[model samples]
Target: MPIQKVTRDEILQKALGVFKRQGYHRTTMDDLARACGLLKGSFYYYFDSKETLMKEVLWWVNRTSEQRIFSVAYQHELPPDERLGLFLDRLYAAVLVSEGGCIMGNTVLETAMITDEFKEPMLVFFTNWTNAVAHIYETAYPTAQALKLAQQLAAEIEGSLLLVKLGSPESLLRDCRERAINRLNVPMHDCTSNP
Candidate 1:
């Protein structure tokens, strides 16, 4: 058989799992290569360094979140309650409830102090997340209050995810979700309803 070509996205997808499980510092290039079914040398062809690969992984995650989670906040036809619930549900499914916890959170704790490059993408992720939640909250409150509530909700969910990672009951996440919906003060309805 001839040598197979690996796309950048394929490498990043495999690398993300390994990085999430083993963390940025603990994961070696060789480990990422194995995860992608490539030799160590081939891994270098895709990324000049682990940091470069990790940055792209963060970008990929941000793009995925924009599509699946943040977009719900922009659906003006949906009630705020339903939109918030859907966004939270999609978020939990995508990134929060994983055994490895939130990749952005994990990366922040590991690499925030060491490099500006890593921190920039992580900051963008949180800013985008906060803005999305704020947009939903704006349905009920003034711009200032809505932004405050959005920040609080974002922090609360992150804290809840940390608790889950530390062996707290997963219900903690569910409770956070309920509290967010209630805080928005919009009546709960079927998120799937046409709006």
Candidate 2:
């Protein structure tokens, strides 16, 4: 039989799903290899260890979210509501509503206290998220108030993700998005976008 080939990006993406669902401590190289459709031993050809794969996964997730979701806040050409609303929509679609729910958040909860390997990328992801959120809130309030509101938004959305992991309805996230938009005093009818 011919050997199966996979790209590093593919391996990282697959590893992310497993890590998100099972966490860093619970996941094994075997689990990653299976997810990537490679043999257990094949992982060494790509990643030196599960820790290496996880660090790569964290960076991959951060890069992807930064480009797709968080960067929307920094796009100054867009209106405040559109930028924030689109950011929330893309955030829900990419992370919150997913089966495992926010790889960065889940990984931090599992590995942050035990190991420092994952801390840098994890902090980068959350800090970027908080900064992006604070950027949107800055449009309405003073700098300090905006930062506080951003923290509040992060807390609310993160808590709602916990509900999603518990088999709660997606409406909880929807409500969070709506509240986020409504806080900007955007009309309720304007929130037609949900992904």
lDDT of 2 by residue, 80-174 (tens): 88999999999888884445898887877787788888899988988899899879877766666667767788889888898878988889988
lDDT tens digits, residues 42-97, model 1?
77888999988999999999998999799999999999899999999999987644
Runs of candidate 1 with Cα error greater than 4 angstroms are 1-4, 186-195
User: Model-by-model lDDT, in order?
Assistant: 0.84, 0.82
lDDT of 1: 0.84
Models 1 onward score TM values of 0.90, 0.90
Model 1 error, position 60 (Å): 1.0
> Residue 49 deviation, candidate 1, in Å?
0.6
Shift in Å, residue 131, candidate 2? 0.7
